[model samples]
Target: MAFDNFYYCVLYEKKYSDYFLYQCILLWMCRKTKSSVTEQQPDSSAIHTISTLPDTNQYLYDFLKMVLADQKLQYSYGLSQEVKNCLYVESDEVYLSRFIITPPQTNPYDQNPSGVDSTKLIYNTDSSVSVNISAQLILNTLTLLPNHACLKKSDITYMMAEKSRLHNLKWNNQKTGFSLTNKNNWYTFSLPYFSKDKKKAFICIQSLCPGLCGSGDVLLYQFKNNKWTSQKVDSWLH
Candidate 1:
């Protein structure tokens, strides 16, 4: 019931009585609570199976191989670290809008800054060559993407879903108390946001190990001459 109607019932109406008012108030409260929960939940489209998209399956397969072999990443591994063996990947697809770069638009003088690298994913650096992929297009969940089964090409363990991954982490924490990295390292991947023509795409991959071992990167991949070339758009480490 509307607030105004509730007030009218309280201040003016007497035939319907306090029981009716209480019922109306309870329904309103229940609706408000439900709406709040819905807003806090993640996008439902992100939790579907990716087996339907054959091309996306192959693309992810190739991209993962490229990432694992990256020399720079291999060098970052400490004596106790490794990417192969018991690696656990998240089963759902994530969206890239969280990692989008948003620059200040108040400065007129800074509008046309020179020396900006076009190859990089700098937002508002140069309008002509700017990476202007649409949010709607990139958020397409229909793109046959990667899942636990598709990621089986690698010699690693893939968690069935986020719930399973979290349960394992919690069980490990209780058993070893964050002191051991054994089977605790995990990786999460975002569904690749493709450009309008499907020749370019952006994806985010995050890895978390026990203690201070963790890192994430937003990568840009361009398909050229039947091969995909990747470059770093942004990254973080801990």
Candidate 2:
């Protein structure tokens, strides 16, 4: 579901290189479309999806090992590992998430992207963290991080709409579907009765390019009755 009717352009942030600051802008704007707001009937027409994640999966901790490959290297030295420290998720919930199959894109020989290649940064009322991933599957690619891993206040966490005046990236309330005064993300989605909102209850993987395999991360949050909650966990997968 691509938009032939799409708007594309560039912005000069002056503070950072065009690629550094604008990558998020590009993702936010050209982000892929969702399956039809209405679902196709599973029928004589055979409307259904059977999903699976690749065996070479690298949840955040596995990614950390890759980043700090040398025995002497510490996790803090790796940019992505540092990013993961900020996003906090439940250990039991860390598993590959399957996504609807979309056409594959032309990746270069040097660019063996694995999962979600986009970086996900989570923000709360008083804290923020970022989840960086490297997955090949459309969905089985993201994980969570903790607030302590957020590192700097100026890191590429909260993205500002290219032309917005406010610092926050305002989005709607996933639960009520109403306009939310507060901005949030972590790829809000659902599971039965759970609201795996980015504000510590959801996760996603967006990229999987090799070297730094284009990656993605899920910023899950726990919002009860409109108030965000806090939590934590630690581990890895490969």
The lDDT of model 2 is 0.31
Candidate 1 wrongly placed segments (more than 4 Å):
1-59, 70-182
TM-score of each: 0.31, 0.16
Off by over 4 Å in 2: 1-200, 208-212, 224-238
Could you give me the TM-score of model 1 versus the true structure? 0.31
Which candidate number has the best TM-score? 1
CA-lDDT, candidates in order? 0.48, 0.31
Residue-level error in angstroms, candidate 1, position 236:
1.0
lDDT (Cα, tens digit) per residue for candidate 2, span 5-119: 2322222334457676588876765553323323443553343323344323223233323222422232221122111222225322222122112354553322334534555
